[model samples]
Target: MSDKVVKRPFVNNNCIGCGACIQVAPNYFDYNKEYLSEAKKCETYNEQDVNNAISVCPVDAISWI
Candidate 1:
Protein backbone atom coordinates (compact mmCIF):
# COMPACT_ATOMS: atom_id res chain seq x y z
CA MET A 1 0.00 0.00 0.00
CA SER A 2 1.07 3.56 -0.58
CA ASP A 3 2.47 5.33 2.44
CA LYS A 4 0.57 8.47 1.57
CA VAL A 5 -1.53 9.19 4.65
CA VAL A 6 -5.01 10.29 3.78
CA LYS A 7 -5.51 13.52 5.57
CA ARG A 8 -9.03 14.35 6.68
CA PRO A 9 -10.24 17.53 8.27
CA PHE A 10 -11.71 17.50 11.76
CA VAL A 11 -13.67 20.15 13.59
CA ASN A 12 -13.58 20.01 17.34
CA ASN A 13 -16.29 21.09 19.80
CA ASN A 14 -14.50 24.38 20.11
CA CYS A 15 -16.07 25.53 16.87
CA ILE A 16 -17.95 28.79 17.17
CA GLY A 17 -20.26 28.31 14.18
CA CYS A 18 -18.13 30.69 12.17
CA GLY A 19 -18.35 30.12 8.43
CA ALA A 20 -14.92 31.48 7.70
CA CYS A 21 -13.54 28.04 7.02
CA ILE A 22 -16.48 27.15 4.82
CA GLN A 23 -16.01 30.31 2.83
CA VAL A 24 -12.34 29.57 2.40
CA ALA A 25 -12.83 25.93 1.43
CA PRO A 26 -16.41 24.72 1.06
CA ASN A 27 -15.28 21.34 -0.23
CA TYR A 28 -13.70 20.48 3.09
CA PHE A 29 -16.28 21.74 5.56
CA ASP A 30 -19.97 22.32 6.27
CA TYR A 31 -22.43 23.32 8.94
CA ASN A 32 -24.09 20.89 11.32
CA LYS A 33 -27.65 21.03 12.74
CA GLU A 34 -26.30 23.21 15.53
CA TYR A 35 -24.88 25.67 12.98
CA LEU A 36 -21.40 24.68 14.06
CA SER A 37 -18.78 23.93 11.46
CA GLU A 38 -17.92 20.28 10.75
CA ALA A 39 -15.56 18.61 8.34
CA LYS A 40 -17.13 16.78 5.48
CA LYS A 41 -16.75 13.03 6.00
CA CYS A 42 -15.46 10.09 4.00
CA GLU A 43 -13.44 12.18 1.65
CA THR A 44 -9.81 13.03 1.11
CA TYR A 45 -8.62 16.50 0.17
CA ASN A 46 -5.36 18.15 -0.76
CA GLU A 47 -3.33 19.50 2.14
CA GLN A 48 -3.51 23.02 0.75
CA ASP A 49 -7.30 22.89 0.56
CA VAL A 50 -7.69 21.68 4.15
CA ASN A 51 -5.02 24.02 5.39
CA ASN A 52 -6.78 27.01 3.89
CA ALA A 53 -9.91 26.18 5.83
CA ILE A 54 -7.98 25.59 9.02
CA SER A 55 -6.20 28.90 8.68
CA VAL A 56 -9.49 30.73 8.45
CA CYS A 57 -11.12 29.14 11.47
CA PRO A 58 -11.25 31.87 14.07
CA VAL A 59 -11.89 29.43 16.87
CA ASP A 60 -9.02 27.19 15.73
CA ALA A 61 -11.40 24.22 15.72
CA ILE A 62 -10.24 22.68 12.48
CA SER A 63 -7.30 20.28 12.12
CA TRP A 64 -6.04 17.24 10.28
CA ILE A 65 -6.37 13.67 11.56
Candidate 2:
Protein backbone atom coordinates (compact mmCIF):
# COMPACT_ATOMS: atom_id res chain seq x y z
CA MET A 1 0.00 0.00 0.00
CA SER A 2 1.09 3.54 -0.67
CA ASP A 3 1.95 5.87 2.16
CA LYS A 4 -0.93 8.23 1.57
CA VAL A 5 -3.68 9.69 3.69
CA VAL A 6 -6.68 11.52 2.36
CA LYS A 7 -7.57 14.89 3.78
CA ARG A 8 -11.07 16.03 4.57
CA PRO A 9 -12.28 19.41 3.37
CA PHE A 10 -13.87 21.87 5.79
CA VAL A 11 -16.48 24.16 4.31
CA ASN A 12 -17.44 26.71 6.84
CA ASN A 13 -20.17 28.27 4.76
CA ASN A 14 -21.61 25.03 3.52
CA CYS A 15 -21.96 23.60 7.00
CA ILE A 16 -25.59 23.65 8.03
CA GLY A 17 -25.28 23.64 11.78
CA CYS A 18 -24.92 19.90 11.68
CA GLY A 19 -23.56 17.88 14.57
CA ALA A 20 -22.59 14.83 12.58
CA CYS A 21 -18.94 15.79 12.42
CA ILE A 22 -18.88 16.25 16.16
CA GLN A 23 -20.53 12.88 16.71
CA VAL A 24 -17.97 11.11 14.59
CA ALA A 25 -14.91 13.00 15.81
CA PRO A 26 -15.61 14.57 19.15
CA ASN A 27 -11.95 15.45 19.55
CA TYR A 28 -11.75 17.15 16.20
CA PHE A 29 -15.15 18.81 16.05
CA ASP A 30 -17.59 20.39 18.43
CA TYR A 31 -20.96 22.12 18.33
CA ASN A 32 -21.21 25.82 18.89
CA LYS A 33 -24.01 27.53 20.82
CA GLU A 34 -26.10 27.50 17.66
CA TYR A 35 -25.68 23.75 17.33
CA LEU A 36 -23.30 24.14 14.41
CA SER A 37 -20.18 22.04 14.29
CA GLU A 38 -16.90 23.85 14.72
CA ALA A 39 -14.23 22.28 12.57
CA LYS A 40 -10.77 22.17 13.93
CA LYS A 41 -7.57 22.55 11.94
CA CYS A 42 -5.21 19.63 12.30
CA GLU A 43 -1.99 18.71 10.53
CA THR A 44 -2.72 15.00 10.39
CA TYR A 45 -5.82 13.14 9.37
CA ASN A 46 -8.14 11.18 11.63
CA GLU A 47 -8.93 8.41 9.17
CA GLN A 48 -11.69 6.61 11.04
CA ASP A 49 -13.35 9.76 12.29
CA VAL A 50 -13.12 11.51 8.96
CA ASN A 51 -14.65 8.54 7.23
CA ASN A 52 -17.38 8.41 9.79
CA ALA A 53 -18.08 12.13 9.45
CA ILE A 54 -18.27 11.84 5.70
CA SER A 55 -20.75 9.03 6.04
CA VAL A 56 -22.79 10.93 8.60
CA CYS A 57 -23.03 14.27 6.81
CA PRO A 58 -26.54 14.86 5.56
CA VAL A 59 -25.69 17.52 2.98
CA ASP A 60 -22.58 15.79 1.66
CA ALA A 61 -20.59 18.94 2.32
CA ILE A 62 -17.55 17.20 3.78
CA SER A 63 -15.14 16.35 0.97
CA TRP A 64 -12.23 13.89 1.19
CA ILE A 65 -9.04 14.35 -0.73
Where does candidate 1 have its weakest 10-residue lDDT segment?
1-10
lDDT of 1 by residue, 1-65 (tens): 47555877889999999799989888878899999988887545778878888887888898888
Best by TM-score: 1
**Model 1 per-residue lDDT at 45:** 79
Task: Quote the lDDT for 41 in model 2.
Answer: 70
TM-scores, one per candidate: 0.85, 0.64
True lDDT of residue 15, candidate 2: 75
Index of the highest-lDDT prediction: 1
Q: How many backbone clashes does candidate 2 have?
A: 0
Q: How does model 2 score by TM-score?
A: 0.64
